[model samples]
Target: MNARLVVVAVGVGLSVAGCNVAGSRLPDPHLSGRDAQYMALVPTADVGAAYERYLVDFKTSEPPGSIVVDTKNKFLYFVEGGGKAIRYGVATGQEAYGWTGRATIGGMQEWPRWIPPKDMLERWPHLQPTADAGGLPGGPDNPLGSRALYLHEGGKDTLYRIHGTNEPDKIGQSVSSGCIRMRDIDAIDLYNRVKLGANVVVI
Candidate 1:
């Protein structure tokens, strides 16, 4: 069977209701080196097959290679044009902390060191210790799990990211402060496909 057949067999429905919280098998062809090693030890999340990555029939005006994040549905779409896109499950920001707007992928990193932003520290004073300690080093234990795509707006760092998350179980929930979170493996997959300065639309 061809790729299209495979997608059809896997089924393609971007709906968020009544999803099963069961782990889905995923491909790691893009993973390598430290990414492979660390991700191997991270347990797969039960985000359900609906939330698993898939090449689906999509309708969007965004050009191919651009990212459109549906914050409401907890899904992110990497537009592939021709009415197609690669959809990945995501953990978006909570209502009070949500951010929706256009941005660009100004920076990208693998196993990126995470320094809690100043505002984040202000919001949660307990994290001041981590901030004073110069933040957490990147690894499986870090909140920014395996990769980070820094979002920038108006040529300035927006302090928001579409990055890997240590809290994989939150994949389909609205739980983060503001950044978008993906499973470690999925982050690596997206990292491989995204290029610097690519457009990102969060809605």
Candidate 2:
């Protein structure tokens, strides 16, 4: 073979080898690292639809002192009266469908830690240690992203939360274990507005 041709062949071989190595190390963009922590949580097709609808302008007629949670539609409306309501996109319970009735916002927190429930750990052994350890630290990576509003009824914790999620893409779907999740930014805005001990009516 010609000397120049032989050199070109060797260069081509090295290029092919480099391409293979680079491809192997590339991470899966579709699967987020935080997603692994919540075993039951998964992406749904409805999330995209929720985002689009939320952006569009619509007339809201809910009255003040009422909380309307349209789970199927993925919206949480805090009525401000006079044919107006503050609408917030939310992620609802994945398994516990259509939670109705009234409750109160017992407490609120910023960057709240997430403690896995006993039943959750029992179902998924991977969460055993974390369950006993108390909970995940409050941060961007935490499932509860920025804020949490604890729900109570008759002065007892209902174990339900209106909180923030790091998974902004999952907003507006039934994808959480049971908590109502909002985007981190939106939740922070809400956290500032809603007073503690406010009445919350879910529909």
Candidate 3:
């Protein structure tokens, strides 16, 4: 089935509530190499929605360059204005514990190493690696895939991130530890699109 038809059949409100997308057409995924590998798996998922990256028409008043994350639906929308947007499937942390509200993109890293939070380590010390102080090095197998966007507020770190994941199939779920997880390729694409100080709303 065509991507647009597949989208409605899968029931994503035909284009998100209030999205007001002019049409149902969606562009192809922008990716290659490792990115393509992850994105390819997305279309094959059984989640019933076309969760792969889609350059869809979106209607919003959030301003261009702003990001709106619909955590409940596991979708992230990057408002491109003129009634356009890039939608990416995402996996969020536990509902009750996930980070929500306004934040800004404070920093980003490519192939960022994994840094186990203190509480996480305290709860699962056995997962700790003795290899390095900064945690696991960046790689295709690393959870932080190709990039990371650190979220912050008022110049302080929020400890929540929108980053790539090695687990591409998990993109449309609610099973993360408290971060926004994207396909490695999608993550890289988002990292490139977002700039420091850009506004982000998680609702």
The TM-score values for the models, in the order shown, are 0.85, 0.68, 0.77
lDDT for predicted candidate 2 compared with the true structure:
0.60
lDDT of 1: 0.79
Give the candidate order by descending lDDT.
1, 3, 2
Q: Encode model 3's per-residue lDDT on 72-151: one tens digit a residue.
A: 77889888888788888788877555766777899889778887776567667875772236688777767767789887
Measured by TM-score, the strongest candidate is: 1
* RMSD versus native structure for model 3: 8.7
Question: Per-residue lDDT tens digits of candidate 2, residues 70-166?
Answer: 6666777655555444566687877443355567889898778888876566667897788678889877777887789987777877777888787
Clashing pairs in 3: none
How far out, in Å, is residue 128 in model 3?
Answer: 2.8
Q: How does each model score on lDDT?
A: 0.79, 0.60, 0.71
lDDT of 1 by residue, 1-203 (tens): 00010001212233333343333344665666887788877756688777888776677767789998888778888877887777899999877778887889999999898887877777778988888889899888889988999988778787888999888999989899888999988898898888999988887
lDDT winner, 1 or 2: 1
Better-scoring candidate (TM-score), 1 or 3: 1
- Where in model 1 is the C-alpha error above 4 Å? 1-26
